[model samples]
Every structure is written in structure tokens, then in C-alpha cells.
Target: MDAITQNLDLFWNGFLRSLTICLWGGVGSLVLGTFIATCRVAPVAPLRTFGTAWVTVIRNCPLSVLLFMFAFGLPEIGINAEYYYFGLAALIIYTSAFVCEGLRAGINSVSAGQAEAARAIGLTFTQTLTQIVLPQAFRTSIPPVGSVIIAMFKNSAVVGAFGVGLDLYSVGESLTSAQGFAALPVLTGVAIGYLMITLPAGVGLGVLERKVAIAR
Candidate 1:
């Protein structure tokens, strides 16, 4: 209790930073991933190839490695930015590949007949997908997308390793080192802090999933 009271600022800032990362990261990845997924399923062979290469390369690369490059290597190439932004960028890029795959799976789940019907009705490929396919695909995709977002929430901790002060892990370490705080208590608070954020998010996503399922 004493330890927690003393470091209230750290814990609060950490929680806000984590929430920021998760929100921005989820949004960024979803948009980019959706585009990539479209490319993967596009009529053009070149677009499909490009999307395949992107997913293959980015998905196969380790998240830590991506973070390291964004945190340390980007500065070397003269793309320096704020530490927080760099960390966010890393999370966005790394998680986008997974998002792409999940969306692609949903896109694939859409029936071929639907696409044919759209075409028969004089819809272009783009119109067919945007209007008829993606809507249904998103419903099927809610579960996997929620899972990806949850994973991204947890993975946001990795930024702390790079000394990003806004991160919960970094804040907890700072308190322990500077204040001689008890590690267990500080860590427990951190765990609970994460739960506070993730639990509601999970519940909300679950509700959305159920609603989408019922609508289907």
C-alpha cells in the first residue's frame, strides 16, 4: 500500500501511455492491414505478390528485432523522432502484419459465389469487395481481430525495454531503482494496472463478437 501510494504518478502515467499505444497501434495496424489484405486478394497478380511479400517479410520478422531497429537503427538513418513515437511506430508496424493475416482470413471466408453475384450484377472487383465482401468478412473477423488487439496491448510493454518513460514496465523499473521500492508490490500494481485496461477491452470486444454473431 505504501509502495503504491508513493508511486501513483508512475502507475497512472504508465497506464495512460499503455492505453495510448494500444489505441493508436490498433487503429494504425487495422487500416494498414486492411489495405494489405485487399492487395493480397486483389485481381492483379502484382498486387497479390506485393501483399504476399509484405506479410511474409514483416510477419516472419521478430517483434523485438523490429523494435530494436525502430528505436536504435532509425536514428542512424536520420529518421530520428521522439522516443515515444518511435516505440509506437514499432508497435504499429510489427502488429500490422498479424492484422493483415487475420483480415485476409476473413476475406477468404467470404463465399466465391458472392463475388460472382456481384460481378454478374455489374459490380467491379473493387466495388464488389468493398460493398459485399468486406462487410461480411469483418463480422467473421471480429474474434481474430480482437485477439490481435489484445496481443498488441500486452506487447506494448516491449517499448519499456528501450527506456521509453511512458511505459508501465519502464515506470516500474524506475521506481524500484530510484526509490528502492519493493519489486513485488510495484510489479503487482503494474499487473493489475494492465488488467484494468485489458479486461474492459476484452469484455467489450466479446460483446461485439456476440452481437455480430447474432446478426449473422
Candidate 2:
């Protein structure tokens, strides 16, 4: 209580920063992941290979390594940016692989006959995917996609460790190390801050899942 009250501004700013990262990262990952999933299931052999390689390499790589590369290595090639953007990029890139896999599973659940029918009727691959397959695939994939997003939100804590910004983890670190506060209270506050974001998101996803199920 004392630690949090004394440093309200720090906590507030940290909370906002974490939220911002999650928001941008979530949208970026979903869009990129969807495109990758589409490519993975496309008629073109080269696209399928590219998508496969992307998911394979990225899924095998550690998130921390990606963050290190983005945070430190990018500057060597003169593609410098703020640490915040670098961290967000890492988060999106890392999470998008998982998102791609989840969506690909959903896309696979769609029947092959439907795609064959669409082609027989002169529907292009793009039309077949966007109009028929992806809509159903998204519905089928809500739960897994929601889980990925939740994990990404929690993972955002690591960003501050790479000096991305003064996020919740950094706030706790500052209070405990620099400000001489007890670690317990400072960490508790930080956990609560994360819960504030994740809890509502989890509940909202639950409601969405139920609604989607009902619609089906």
C-alpha cells in the first residue's frame, strides 16, 4: 500500500504502457498471422513453403532472443527505433507464429469439399478463402486465438526488462531496488496491475466464445 500510494504516477504510467503494447501487438499479430495462415493453405507451392518456413523458424525461436535481436541488433544495421517499438515488434512477431498455427488448424477443420465446390463454380482461391473458409475458420479458432492473445499480454512484462519502457515490471523493479521498498508489496501491486488487464480480457473472451458457440 505504501509503496503503491507513494508512487501512483509510476504505477499509472507503467499500466498504460503495458496496455498500449498489448493493444498494438494484439492487432498486429492477428493481421499478420491471418495472412500467414492464408498463405500456408494457398494453392501456390511457394507461398505454402514460405509460410511453413516462417512458422517453423519463429515458433522454434525464443521470445527473449527475438527481443534481444530487435532491441540490440537492429541498431547495428541502422534500422534504429525506440525500444518501445522494438519490443512491440518482437512481441507481434513471436506471437503471430502461434496465431498462425492456431488459425491454420481452424482452416484445416474446414471441409475440402467446400473448397472444391467453390473452385468448380469458378470462385477464385481468394474468394473461396475470404467468403467461405476463413469465416468459419475464425469461429472455430476463437478459443485458441484468445488464449494466444492472453499469453501475449502476460508476456508483455518481459518487454520492460529489455528497457522497452517503464512497464509494470520496471515499476516493481524501481520500487524494490532504487526506492528501497519491500519487494512483496511492490510485486503484489504489479501482479494486480497485470490481472486488471488479463482478467477482463479473459472474461470478454469467454463471453465471445459462448456467443460464437451459440451462433454455431
Candidate 3:
């Protein structure tokens, strides 16, 4: 309590940074994942191959390794950016693979007959996917996609260790190491900070899931 009370500003800043990471990371993953999911289901064989390869390689790689690559390897290739962007990039790339898979599963859940019906009505593959498939797919995919986002929120803690030190985990580290605060209270504060983000998100997802289920 004393640790948190004494360092309220630090904790608040960390919370905001973590929230920012999650916001951008979540949006990036969803957009990129949706594109990849579309490619995986497209008529073009090359697109399908690329999608498969992306999911395979990225899903298999460890997040830490990806972070190291984004944090260090990007600079080596003359793509200099702030550590914050690098951390966000790593989170976006890693989480997007799982997001792609979740959406692909939702796409598969969509009835094939609807797509065929659209095709028979002179609709192109893009039109059928965009108009007929993706809408229903997104509704059905809310659960898994929500879960992935929550996991990504938790995973954002790892970003602090990789040099994005303005997050909750890093704040706790700073309090304990630099300010001589006890590790226990500092860690408790960090956990609460994360919970403040994830708990509400979880509840909101549950409500959304129920609503989608009712709609279905």
C-alpha cells in the first residue's frame, strides 16, 4: 500500500503505457489477422500458401525470440525505431498469428452453401467473402478472438523486460530496485494494474459472447 501510494504517479504512468500497448497491439493484430484469414480462405493458391506459411512460422516461434528480432535485428537492418514501437510490433506480429487462426476457424464455421449461393448469384469470391462470410465469421469468432486479445494483454508484460520499461512490470521493478520498496507490495500493485485492464475486458467479452449467442 505504501509502495503504491508513494509512487502513484509512476503506477499511473505505467498503467497508461500498458493500456496504450494493448490498444494498438489489439487493433493491429485484428486487422492483420483478418487479412491473413481472408488470404487463407481465398481462391488464390499463392495467397493460401503465404497465409499458411505465415501462421506456421509465426505461431511456432517464441514471443521472446520475436521481440529480440524486432528489438535488435531491426536496427541491424537500418530500420531504427523506438523500443516502444519494436515491442508493440513484436506483440502485434505474435498475437496476430493466433488471431488469424481463430478467425480462420470462424470462417470455416460459416456454411459453405451460403458462399456457393453467393457465387451462383454472380458474386465474385471477394464479394462473397466480404459480404456473406466475414460478417457471420466475426460474430462466431468473438469468443476465441476475445480470449486471444486477453492473452495478448497479459503478454504485454513481457514487453517491459525487452526495453519498454514504462509498463506495469517495469514500474514494479523500478519501485523495488530503485526505491527500496518491498517486492511483495510492489508486485501486488503491478498485478492489480493488469487486473484493472483485463478484468473489465473479460467481463465485457462474456457479455458480448452471450449477446452473440442470442443473436445466433
Candidate 4:
């Protein structure tokens, strides 16, 4: 217990840093993913192709390779990581592909008849999508989306390899080396941290879904 306590104190700043990385990365992915997914649904053929290609490339690549490329490749071009921007950039790109697929499934699940009905009521396709389709689609996608967000949060641990020194996974690794304990304690902390964020998000999304359903 004392060993764990000592390690906890040693790793506090790292945990806090990791929290920031995960929170921002997950939310950033959600916003950008939603936008790209919307573009894929656009009537324009080029946009659909572009969005599809974007998802394909990122989804097919492993996260570690993508992070390594972003960390090393950008600096060669002068976008240096003196600002920690590279880690965030990598995370956003890595997670966005997943979020895009999740949202695409959600949007597709929205019945075709609903969009047709919305259009019949004098709503433009854009209006119907924004006002009617999205809300319902989001509700339907909440479970899967929440899961993706949690995955993104866990993946944020990968940023430590790019020299984001203070994140949770980094801290855990540091502690394990410094304290010489088994991996159980460090992994336990990481698991708890993930559940702490994701469980509440899942519950809240569930509540929101029920509220929307009731309103309808």
C-alpha cells in the first residue's frame, strides 16, 4: 500500500497531463469526425470520395505508426513539437477515423423514410439533416460513440512515445521502473482512469437518448 501510495504521488502530474490529452483528443475527434461523416453524406460525389478515402487511410493504419510519423515527419518539415502540438495532432487524426465510421453507422441507421418525410414537410435536405436526422442519429449512436470515445482516451496513452512526458501511461511506466513493482498497480490505475471518464459519459448519453425519445 505504501509503495502504491508513493508511486501515486510520483505520477500525479503525469495523470493530470494524460487527462488533458485524452479529453481534448476524444472531443476533437468527435467534432471533426461528425463533420467528415456529414461530408460523406453530401450530394457531391467528390466530397463523398474524399471523406471515404480519409476514413479508409486512417482506419487501415495502426495508431502507433501514425503517431510515429506525425511526431517525426512534422518536425522534419519545421512544425516542431516544442509546443506539444504534435501529440494532439496525432491523436486527433488517429481517433477521427474511428469516430467517422461510428457516426456513419449512426447516420445510416436513421431511416430513409425519416429523411423523405422531413423533406416532404418543406425542409431542405440540409435542414432535415441538421434539425431532424442528426439528433436522432446521435441518440442511436450514443452507445457506440461512447465506446469509441473511451477507446480514444485509452489510445491517448500512445502519445507518450512521442515525448509527451507527463501523460498517464508515461507516468505509469515511469513509476513501474522507478518503484520496481509488478504491472498490476500501474495498469489498474490506467483502467480506473478510463472508467472514471467513460462510465459517466455513457450514463449521460443514455439519459440524453431517453430524453429525446420521450420528447418524440
Candidate 5:
């Protein structure tokens, strides 16, 4: 109790930074991933090829490598931004691959007969995808997409490695060293803090999944 009261400000700062990263990263990834998934399944050969290559390459890369690339490598190429934005970009780009795959799997789960029927009605590729496929894909995608968002929220801690001064990992380190708190207690607090974000997200996604569940 005493320790928590003393560290409330640190905890609050960490929480806010983490939330910012997750919020932007989650939205960016979802939008990009959906686009990539659509392209991957597109009728056009070139679009499908490009999407396959992107998912294959990005999905295989280690996330830490991607973050380090954005953090240190970008400035060498004359694309500089605040370290925080670089971290946010890394989270979005890396997580977007997983998001792409999750959505692709959901899109695949959609019945082929439905797509055929849509096409039979003279629907173009975009129309069939948007009007018929993506809605169902999104609903079927809830569990995996939820997992990706939760993973992104936790991954925001990695930004601290690049000297983002106020992220959860940095704040936790500050508490242990500067404030003289023991490591275990500080780490435990950090873990609980992450759970406070992720657990609710999981529960809420579960409810949404149930509500929109596709009839098998």
C-alpha cells in the first residue's frame, strides 16, 4: 500500500504512455492488415503476389529487429522522427503482419460458396469483398485479432529499450533504482498494470465475438 501510493505517479505515467502506443498502434495495424489481407486474396495476380510477399517477409522478421531498425536505422536513411514515433511505427508495422495473417485466416474461413454467389450476382471483386466477405471475416476474426491487440499492448513495453523515457519499462526501472524499491515488487506492479489493460480487452472482445458469432 505504501509503495503503491508512493509510486502512483510513475504508474500513471507509464499507463498513459502505454495506452497511447497501443491505441495508435492497434488502429494503424488493423487498417493496414485489413488492406493487406484483401490484397492477398484479390483476384488480381499482382496484388496477391505483393501481399503474399509482404506477409511472408514481415511476419518472419523478429519484432526487436524491426524496432531496432526503425529506432537506429531510420535516421541513417534521413527519415527521422521522435524516438517515440519510431517506436509506435515499429509496433504498428510488426503487429500489422500478425494482424494481416489473422484477418487472412478469417477471410479464408468465409465460405467459398458465398463468394461465388456474390460474384454470380455480377459483383466485382471489391464489391464482393466489402459487401459480402469482410464483414463476416471481421466477426470470425475477433479472437485472433483480440490476441493481436493484447500482444500489441504488451509489446509497447519494448519501446522503453529505445529510450522512450516514460514507458512502462522505463518507469518500472526508475522505481527500482531511483526510488529504492525492490525489483520484485516493482515488476509485480508492472505485471498487474498490464493485466489491467489486457484482461478487460480480452473480456470485451469475447462478448463481442459471442454477439456477432457466425452461424456454422
Candidate 6:
């Protein structure tokens, strides 16, 4: 109990940092994801092929490896190390690929006639996609998108692997190193912190899916 009280600040800071990374990755990836998904499903075969390759390669590659490559490898190529952004960049690349597929699936769920109707109403392809297609697709895709959000949320811990300061997993390691006596309790606290981020979003996503289904 004393140990728990003593280390609350450390746990709080680390969890917040981890969460910040997740939030950035989640939102950043979605923007890029929508664009990539749209282009992948474009009539142009070359765009489709390139997008497909991007998604496939990122999905298959282990995230830790991606982190290693970006954090260490980029500097060797004259890109230099900016720790937070490197993690953020890798995360954006990784999660965008996934969110691309998720959004693509959601876009496909919308009927082609809806887009045709939007075009009939004087909306350009971009406007039709933004106003008509994506809005509804977002509702339908709540679960999948939520899953990706949570995944990015959890996987942000991987950023700690590259020695970024004060993220949750790294903090856990630091705590273990600092207080050899309280390692179990410290890690358990970290686990709970992660659940706090993950579980609520998951439940909210379930509610969203149900609401969308009922309205349909």
C-alpha cells in the first residue's frame, strides 16, 4: 500500500504519455486512412495496386520491427532522430494502413446508388464521398474502427521500446528497476491503466454498432 501510494505520480505520467501517443496515432491515421482507402478503391489500377501494397506491407510487418527500422534506420539515411515524431510517424504509417482497410470495408457497405444519387444532386465525387458515403460508412464501421483505435492505443506502448521517454511500458521498466521490491504491483498498476484506456472505448463502440443497427 505504501509502495502504491509512493509511485502514483510515475504511473500517472507514463499512462498519460502512452495515451497521448495513442490519441495522435488514432486521429492522424484516420485522416490518411480515408484518403488511401478512397484511392485504393479508385478506378485507377495503379493507384489501387500501390495502396494495396502499402497496406499489405505495413500489416504484415511487425510493429516493433517498424519502430526499430524508423528509429534507428532513418537516422543513418540523413533523416535524423526526433524521438516522438518518429514513433508518431511509424504509428501513423502502421495504423493508417489498417484504418484504410476498415474504412474501405465501410465504404463498400454503402450502396453504389447512394453515390449516384449524390452526383445527381450536384455533389462532386469528393463532396459525395465526404457528405453521403463516409458519414454512413462511419456508423456502420464503428466496431472495426474502434478495434483499430484500441489496437493503436495499446500498441503505442511499443513506442517505449525505442527509448522514448516516460511511456507506460518504459515506465514500468523504470519502476521495476527503481524499486525491485514493488515490481509486481507496479506492473499490475500499468495493466489497469491500459484497461482504463481500452475497455471504455470498446464498450462505447458496441453501443455505437447497436445504435446504427437499430436505426437501419
User: How much lDDT does each candidate structure score?
Assistant: 0.86, 0.90, 0.91, 0.77, 0.87, 0.85
Model 2: CA > 4 A from native: 113-131, 214-216
lDDT of prediction 6 = 0.85
TM-score of each: 0.89, 0.89, 0.91, 0.83, 0.90, 0.88
* Top candidate by TM-score: 3
Q: C-alpha displacement of 105 in model 1, angstroms?
A: 0.9
**86-152: candidate 5 lDDT, tens digit per residue:** 8888888888889989988888899999999999999999999899988998788888988999999
Clashes of each: 0, 0, 0, 0, 0, 0
Give the lDDT of residue 157 in candidate 6: 80
Per-residue accuracy of model 2 over 90-123 as CA lDDT, tens digit each = 9999999999999988878888887899899999
What residue runs in model 5 are displaced by over 4 Å at the alpha carbon? 118-130
What tens-digit string does per-residue lDDT give for candidate 1 at 23-123? Answer: 99989999888889889988999999999999999988988888888878988989988878888888888888889899888888888998999999999
Candidate 1, residue 171: Cα displacement in angstroms equals: 1.5
Task: Write candidate 4's Cα lDDT for 1-216 as tens digits.
Answer: 444577676566776787788878877888999888878888999999999999999888988787778777888897775525777887898788888888888888888898899999999978997998888888777767777877777777777755677676766676677657678877687667657767887788777667655243
lDDT of the structure predicted as candidate 1: 0.86
* Candidate 5, lDDT over the whole model: 0.87
Instruction: For candidate 2, give the lDDT.
Output: 0.90
lDDT of 6 by residue, 1-216 (tens): 554568889888988899889888888999998878878998999999989999999999988888888888999989986788898889889999999999888878899898999999899988997899889888777778789989998888878767787988887888778667477787888888899988898888888778786254
Q: For model 1, which pairs clash?
A: none
Error of 5 at 210 (Å): 2.0
Q: Model 1 off-target regions past 4 Å?
A: 117-127, 214-216
Error of 1 at 148 (Å): 0.9
Model 3 TM-score is 0.91
